[model samples]
Target chain A: MTIAATKQFCTFFVGGHYFGVPVLDVQEAIRYQEMTSVPLSSSVVSGLINLRGQIVVAFDLRRRLELPPRSDGAKPMNVVVRHLDGVVSLLVDEIDDVVETDEVTFEPAPATLKGVAREVILGAYKLKNRLLLVLDIEKVLSIEAITSGDGDDNAS
Target chain B: MTLVGELVLARNQVLQFSATQSDPALLSATQQLNLLTSELQESVMKTRMQPIGKLWSKFPRVVRDLAGICGKRVRVQMEGEDTELDKTIIEAIGDPLTHIIRNAIDHGIEEPAIRTRRGKPEEGKLSLKAFHEGGQVNIEISDDGAGINVEKVRAKVLKQGLISPEQLTRMSERELIQLIFLPGFSTAEQVTSVSGRGVGMDVVKTNIEKIGGSLDIHSELGKGSTIKIKIPLTLAIIPALVVTSDSCRYAIPQVSLLELVRLDSEIAFKSVENIHGAPVYRLRGKLLPLVYLSSVLNTGSAQLNQDVASIDIVVLQADKLQFGLVVESIKDTAEIVVKPLGHHLKSASVFAGSTIMGDGKVALILDVVGLAEHAGLASKVEAIAASNLAGIQNDSTEGEKLLLVGVGDNSIAIHLSTVARLEEFPASAIESAGGRPVVQYRHGILPLVDLADFTGGYSAFSQNESPFQVVVCSGPHGIMGLIVDRIIDVVQENIQIQLIGERHGFIGSSIIHNKMTDLLDVHAVISSIDPSFFDEMKEALIGGVR
Candidate 1:
C-alpha cells in the first residue's frame, strides 16, 4: 500500500479567497494595531506596525494580490511570517484555522488563474469546504513588482 | 566550575522547573539562579578582555626607529599599560595609535639642537598613556616638544583659500588648531616621507570613529601637543534611546544623542520659528537647525501645527553640528542589539540598520551621519551657522554695535564691522551698467545691490524724489553698495538674535530699543549680487595673509 505524508498549512482569508502558507514559515498571528505609514515607500506597503517592541513592515495582501479591499470596518488580522529577507507581517481580512492535508491532494494552479496572485501560488490543496491556494511566501514578499515600478496588479 | 558550564546548568534548571507547576519556594529558588546567571555573564565577558599593554608592547621599538629617522633625540614613557580593553578595540586602535606616535616624533618634537637652544632637555619626552574613563578607554599621546606652530597651520589654510578671511577673524585659536585634521590639510612645508604624504589626521579620525571612538587634539604653543582618543567597550551592543516619530519607533544611538527638550504648544511656536520654510529652534541663545522626523521619512505630513498641545524634540550631534529633531514622543531607553537591514532596503539612507526590541518588534536605527547629510546639515552649512551664531551673541565689552538701515517697510541692523562707508545718491546718479546698477564712488565703479529686492522686499526704486542711502559693504569680494530706503543710525544694544529668517541677505531678527529689527547677512548679500565676487577677493586676501 502507498502512503502520503500529511502537511500542515496555516491559512488566512483575504479579498474573498482563502490563502495558505506552510506552517513552518508562519511565525504567529496577531491583531492589527497602530501602524506608522512610511511616506515615499512602495504603494503596497501598508505601513510599519510595532509588534510588541519590534517594528514589523506590514504588507497589504489585498493590494499585493490585486484583489478588492475589505468593505467591512473591522481591523484585518496580521499573519506574521518569515522569509529569507526578514520577518514580515501579512495583512489579511481574517485568520483561519490551521489545516492538515495529504500531499497527494496538492494540485498545480489552474490555467484560468492569472497575474501576480497566480504567479505567487505554488499549488492548491483540495479541502473539504474549499480549495486552499498555497502561497510561495518568498515570491509573495519579493517586492520586485512594487520596487521595479511596473505598477502591474492582478485584479485590476 | 566554568562560567559557561554554570550558565548552561542554570538555564536548563530554569527551563525544567518552568514546565511544572511553580511553587513559591521554587520561584524563589529560580530568582537565586538569575543572580548567579548575571554573575556568570560578567565572568564570561572578562574572557574577551586583555591588558592594553599587549597593544603597547611594540610602541617602544617603533618610536625609537622613527625618532632616529627624524634626527630627533626622544625619550619614551608609558603609564597605565595594564588598563584592560576589548580585544577588538585593541586590534583596531593599533595602527591609528602608531600613526599618532610617528606624527608626534616627526612633527611635534624638535631636533636635539633646537630643543637644547630652547633651554629644555636635549631629548624630547613623548608619553603614551592608557586609562579607563566613564566606561570608555582613553589613550593619550603627548609630546613635550615645540607645540604645533599655529602660524604655519594658519598660513597653509589661507593659501588653500578653503576658508574666508571673515570666518578666520572670528575663529578661536582652538578652532584654528582643529583644521589640521581636515583631509589634504598638511601644515608641513616639506613633504616628509615619514608623516607627510598629505594623508594624515583625517584618516586617523575616520578609523577611530569607525569603532565608535572620538579623537581630540589639544595644543599650546611652546608647551606641547596632546591627542586623546576615547573608545567605547564594544560595538556589538549599544545603549540607545527609543523615540517615536510619526508613530513609528526608531532608535537613536546614545553616543550621538545630546539631550531632549519638550515644549508646550504655545511656547513651542514662539521658541521655534520658520525661516524660508526651514524650521529653527532658539536653544540656549544659539540658533539650532531643526528637522522633522515625519518630513524626512515621507510619512504623515510634517506640519508643525500651531494648535498642537505639545511637541518632543531630541537634540542630537551629527559630526560637529548639533540639530534638534522633532518627534511625536520620547520612549524608554534600552540596550538594543543592532541588526543590519535586508539587502533590498540597504539603499535607504535614513536608516543605519534595524534592531529587534525587547518585545521582538523591529526598530530601525537611524544613521546619524546619513540623516545629517540628507537634511543638508553639512560642515559648510554648520560653519556658516556658527559664524552667524557668533555674530548674534555680540556681547563684547565694546557693546553690540550694529548699523541700522531701512529696507522696503522694515528696518534692519547690519554688523558695523561689515560696513566700510556710507554714501548717498540721487536717482539720476545711479546708472545701469553691465545689467547692474552702479554708482561712481571714491575712484571706481561700485556695484549697487538692492537690499529690498535681495531680501524679497519690493523694489525700493520708484518715483521718489528722496535720495537713496547706500551702505558700502566690503567682503572677500570687491566693495559693493547696498542701496537702502534710509540710513537710520549706528547703535549699540544688548540685543540677541531671537528670530532667524531665511532670506538672501537677512541673518535673523533681534529686538533693538524694544523694536524687532531684522539682521542682514552682508557677505551673502554681496555674493548674491556677484557670485564670483569672492573669487577675485580670495587672491587679494591670500596675498595679504601670506
Candidate 2:
C-alpha cells in the first residue's frame, strides 16, 4: 500500500501556545479590524467584524481556551474559516507559518490538557521544537454548549 | 423584480459611471441610465404591490363560515379594498385577519337576542374596511357586537394572577380591555372551539409584529370593537441611519430612529446625570433615558470625551418608549438591505441583523427593540415626563395632589394620580419568583419592587413576620409596590420640586411643611424592576386604546 506524503495545517498562536487547524478548513487570515460587539452573547464571542461586506462572528481563542488575556493588550489577527452557512473569524495572538507533517505523527489529546483547551483540542502533532495542538474548529466554535449551559451529553 | 436585483444593477451603474466620469458623453449617458434605472426600479416596486382587494377576496368566505360556526346573523361589509400593499404583506396578513374576524364573530357581535335587546338590528354588521393611511395599509375589522367587557377581562386577569387588583383599579378602560391579548388569558369562560381556546390574541399580535406591522384594538362597551392592523407597504428595503460606536459601524432602522440630538459638552455635562448608575439626559424639558452603545455590547468605551465640545445622541423610539442612544457619531442615512444573522448568532438580541453598507463593510443593524430591552431602557419614562411637563405647564398655579409615603428615614411624595393604592402584605408572603419579589394581593400576583432598595433607602421590616407596608403605584409596567415603612397622609401641595442629588427613584426634592420630601419617579422605579415589564403594556395600550 502507498502511504500519503503529508497533511498541511495552519498554525496560530494563543496565550504562548501554538495551535493548528487543518489547512483545508482555513479560508484566509487578515489583520484585526474593528468589530461591533453583540450584547448578551456568549463570553467567547469577541464581537462581529465586517469582512468585505460579509458580517463574520469573531470568536476569541484565548477566551474559548480559558487562557489568560494577552498581557500587551494588542489587537489579534483574524483567521477566517468557513463555519456552517457563513464564515467565523478566529481571533489569535499571532499567525504562524503553516506546517506540513505526516498524519502518523498526530496523537490523541493528552489527559494533561487542562480546562477549555482540553474540551476543544482534537489532537496534537509533535514538532521538532514544540507540540502543535490540533484544534477542531467546529468544537471550538460551538457556542451552544456554553450559552445553553448544557453538559456535553447531546451535542450534534 | 426583486429589490436586491435592482440594487445590484444600480450599484453597477454607479460604479461604472464613477470609473469613467472623465468622459463627458459617458457622464451624460450614465446620468440618463441612472434616471431610467431609478424609474425602472419604481415600476418594478409597483409590480410587487397588489391591491388590498386580493387580501379581502377571501374575507367574505371567512366571515360566512365564521357566522355559520357561531350561529350568528352577520353581514361582511368591505370598503377601500382597492388600496394596495406589498404582495408579501397581503399574503402574511391572511391568518391574522382570519383570527380577528373569528374573534369578531364569536365575541364581538353579540347573539341575535342580545343585539335586539340592546336596541340594535338583529342582523349584526361586521365591516372589513381597508384604507391607505400615513404611508401604511390600514385594515379595520369592526363588528357591531357587545364590545369587549373590560370588567370581565379585569376579573379574568385577576383570577389568573397576571396582575393585582390595585393594577386593575389603575388600568384605564382601554387598558383593561387590552388584557384580553395576554397569553393564556381568555375572558371566554367556556372553552370555545371557535375563538377562545386559550390560544389567544398574542399569537395574532406576534404574527402582526413579525411582519413589521402593529395591531390596535379599540372597543366601546355595548357598541362594538374595531381591531386595526397597520402594515408598511414593503419590508424588502428600509431607510436606516448609520451610526458608529467604539469604531464599529451599525445601522439603526429609520422606522425606530425618531431624531438625532447633538449636545455641546457643557450642555451634556449639565443635562446628563447618572441616576443609580443608569445615565439619563435631560432633553428640552423632560428626562430622556440614555444607553451607551459601548456599555451594552461590552465593547470599548464610546470614549466620549467629557471635555469635547459636542456629543451626538440618536433618539430611538422602540414601541412606545423613546430613549437616546449615545454613539460616537452619526453617519449618512441610506436605504439598506437587511440580512438575517446566521443561526449561530441568532441569540444575540442586540443585533436585528446585519446590513452591508455602501462601502461594502458589514454593518450590524441595531435592533432598536432589542437594544432597548438589553440596556433595560424599555420604560414608560417618556410618558411620565410628558405628563409631568403638561402638569408643570398647566397646573403650575394649581395645587397638585400627592401621595405621601414613609420610607426608612425619609418621606417621599409621588403623584397622587400615579398611585394606585396603599396596601400591606405579610413579609412572608413576599416570595421570590422569577428572580423578583412577588406578593399575592386580592387574588392577583403583584410584583413588589422596592424603590428603597434601588435608592439606598432602608426597609424597616426585615423579618417576614412583620406586615410590609406597600405603596402600590401604577406605571406603564403594570403595578409594583414601593415597599415603605408606612403610608403617610395624602397631601395637596403646590411646593416647587427642587433638584437634589441624583437618585434612582427620586425625581427631586421639595419642601413640604417643615421637612424635605423626595419626589418619586414612579415610572423609573417600576422600570428598574423589569425593563420588559412595560414593553407588552405599551403594545396592549396601543392595541386597545388607539
Which model scores highest in TM-score? 2
In TM-score terms, candidate 2 sits at: 0.61
Looking at model 2, residue A113 earns an lDDT score of: 77
**Residue-wise C-alpha lDDT for candidate 1, range B119-215, written one tens digit per residue:** 8899999998988876678899999988888778888888878678787766678778888888888877788878777788889987896676778
Question: Which 10 residues in a row give candidate 1 chain B its minimum summed lDDT?
Answer: B1-10
RMSD of 2: 19.9
- Stretch of 10 with least lDDT, candidate 2 chain B: B378-387
Which residue runs of candidate 1 sit more than 4 Å off their true CA positions?
A1-156, B1-38, B113-121, B144-203, B218-225, B274-289, B296-300, B317-322, B340-352, B367-374, B378-546
- Which stretches of candidate 2 lie above 4 Å from their native place? A1-34, A50-53, A70-156, B1-37, B118-120, B144-192, B195-200, B219-224, B257-306, B311-317, B320-328, B348-350, B371-391, B394-546
TM-score of each: 0.50, 0.61
